[model samples]
Target: MKSSAATDNSSHHVKCDKNNINDDGNNSFIELPPNSRPLEHQIAGHFYDQSKTKYGLLQHSNGDVLKPLLNPPRGPCEEQFYIDVFCQTSKSKYNSEDLINLRKFLPHYLGTYKCQKMSYIILENIIQPFKHPCITDIKIGRITYDKEANEEKIHRMSKNSVVAEIGFQLSGWKIYRSKYYEYHDKRCVRSLNKTDILHGIAYFYGAPIHLRLDVIELVINKLNELQDYMKQQHTFVLISSSLMVVYEGDDNDQELNKSTFVDVRLIDFAHVFPQTNSNQSDENFLFGLANYIDYMKQLLDKNYVYVPIDKFEHDNKTDTKIYSCYKQLLT
Candidate 1:
């Protein structure tokens, strides 16, 4: 995830026109009613050949924009597995647990369909409610900071003040060392340690340092909870992904006010191995998680100054326990 899964297809009746390809021989988007192009994005073709296919938001003229994806499932069974998972995990066991951490780990899985050489999953186009929202999207990967694009991001975020400005949108996941090391620019993040494993961490929005600490703490707690849940449920094995931390909201507001929106989610599921048919360890989640916290602590210091509970209490009136979880995750 450079800041998301697979499923069955025979059951669903859908088709893609293979003839609808561009002159480049790469696949083009399926022929459909003409729609508006994305506000600012590349029109990437969708024919994944073990190559990283670019995923973008399908902004439609009808004002219905959605996050689009192209990736293979773990196998034929992959699609159905997540469909069931999404169904079971759709709503909380109790309304009171609406803020349950289970749903917080991944983007809202809208649904999926198949076409020529690709399986597309539709997810909630994660956008802020603000008229002009600034987004900082980071795709977490198994690469260390020294050898991946993360180094550039770190440098840019640290020195650039506009990164924190309102109306800024920060989106994109971390780079993969094994898969992306060669094809992607050298500036991408890579594993610096002798071992090839890289843990995931957030920038804490860079330079400011204090805010970085708060963001990192929240991220750690979220990862801790998610890692624990995955192990218990045995849902799936995350191999290599550009998982990300999304922060959106007005900047001028108090720190906690930013709590209106902050999420930790896997960007894509290209390397996700379903545990249903395999014996993959959930260790990757835990390992990456701990590594992320440690990496940040070494740079920003481990001590955390309390982000008052009242900061988010305003938004979580009905879910006071969630507010408690926020405070506890930090402590």
Candidate 2:
């Protein structure tokens, strides 16, 4: 189990246990659980093609034969970079009795990704799913580290000095990767794009209409719960990009109900503040809130709220009720 003292000061800690790791020596991998639908690998061969001249084909996960074109050599001319994919993991088994008690107290930390592509790939590939009009064919290359350079980068990041630079990295990655998919299914809602607001409004107004209201409510409730949890720890929540709250419908009956379990996800923390930074002040909180408001306004101005639906009749009033509830909360 990897633990961090810094997380103790945060409102909540995310712990990733041994179960999360499929470790073989220094190479650690986490295999996402099999969903009812196939878990697609969006990057696949695309990663191999980037900077083909450098970072020669190291090795594939499957010992399959590598074609010459697939083999790229790593060289100085190649734009090498690193990314940290941080997540909380547990040290004990899933059913271990210790987890029952320790789970409540575990803290979450940022996952690091060491990758070669520009930082924007992080947003397009990782953050886009949570937003509207989901993107695809985005590949994140391998992770590596330049000890001296990373040390400097980390020092700057901790002081909130490199925020603008980080933002630039995110934006650049987004534009470069946008070529793969110009547009996605309107219903998917990729991120906080204009289409997302429209979809959110449609989901709210079209209610009494069957949709995933519970999932949205679950997410809101979880955020509230996380907020309270963080308060107890004397930490504040920061909105880096957008958060995702998910609920899985019953496959057996194909019905969505409160009984369905909920999963809340916080995405794109490029702007999140670490509790380790003692320099943060109340002003930071206000700034974060202002940013959040700006985002919320974008959603509302795009008709994210369902104004027409309140006029209709429906059995499940929960959608409108919850939307109204969050409207006030967000404002």
Candidate 3:
């Protein structure tokens, strides 16, 4: 119910309009999470409200992703609901960076609603129309510290963990937070979990074999743009951020030489904090993003016969900048 002052930005200013929200707007807020089956319809309805200038999403007093609604559009686009189990840790108000600093979006945020006991944000579904959509979470970030200590902690937890069959990845990292055995199936709705708040899981959409290079360019360019925007906001994405891509299984026309088109969005904002440790934040995302860029290059090199960088070229400066960043991470 409180709105904090927007952080000073060199290139932009962010503010919330008093007319865009009503403190007593809980009339539309549900008390449960969005996975309780019975409230699915209720939670899904928030995305369709067009009466307001910006859509309302539920949030709490502490800036967590639930129990309160955050309004104010970043651009001329529709407002989006930014919710999840994680809340802002430093201040009393929600970190406006959760939505403002983002360079990509799942879709326009509508408002907030809950299913059963958990709260959920309703927004335009990015993958509803894509066919046979399969999303994989790639936990990306530089492995600077000896992962041995982190891995050991994970090992100890596994020894005392519940024997749930549906959780845990091969590397023992927990990624089952929001897996739908079938993405398009309605029966797979579940509560958001700890991984949603912790892991920087980037969901890469499977693209046709031919267009992999184009897609990788799209991903890289977006990250570069994001880094610039984050710096302007005087905020840095210090934590792990994700890249979610949604694509189709449409015909890979052997004759149509063009790269296949895809829709991609970045998710997860738990580690995105204020600009206190800007240097480290830059290190985390630059190296982390560079690492992902290399991964894609390797995948395309081995699987495809052609690699065309011009499909999404910027300029010589960009190529040098990106390549140089890649070299830094590798060396």
TM-score of 2: 0.32
Q: Is candidate 2 or candidate 3 better by lDDT?
A: 3
lDDT of candidate 2 vs native?
A: 0.28
**Candidate 3 wrongly placed segments (more than 4 Å):** 1-107, 143-211, 227-233, 236-240, 253-260, 278-281, 299-331
lDDT by residue for model 2 over 73-99, one digit each (tens)?
Answer: 222101111111222234211222322
Clashes of each: 41, 45, 17
Q: Compose the digit string of candidate 1's lDDT tens values, residues 43-68.
A: 12222222243334454453333333
User: RMSD of each candidate?
Assistant: 15.3, 16.2, 16.8
Alpha carbon lDDT at 102, candidate 1: 44
Best by lDDT: 1
Q: Candidate 1 regions off by >4 Å?
A: 1-33, 36-57, 60-81, 88-101, 113-119, 130-186, 190-204, 208-211, 253-257, 274-281, 297-331
- Give the winner by TM-score: 1
| TM-score computed on alpha carbons, candidate 1 | 0.50
C-alpha lDDT score of every prediction, in listed order: 0.39, 0.28, 0.35
Write down the worst ten-residue block by lDDT for model 1: 177-186
Model 3, span 1-331: residue lDDT tens = 1122122121111233333323355534322222222211112212223224223333332333322223222111111213321222243233455445452443434344433222244334444444433343333344322222477655653452211222221111111112222121111111213332111122222322234455556656655665455445444343434555544434353553234345555544434434565344455555555545544555455443332323122246754443211111111
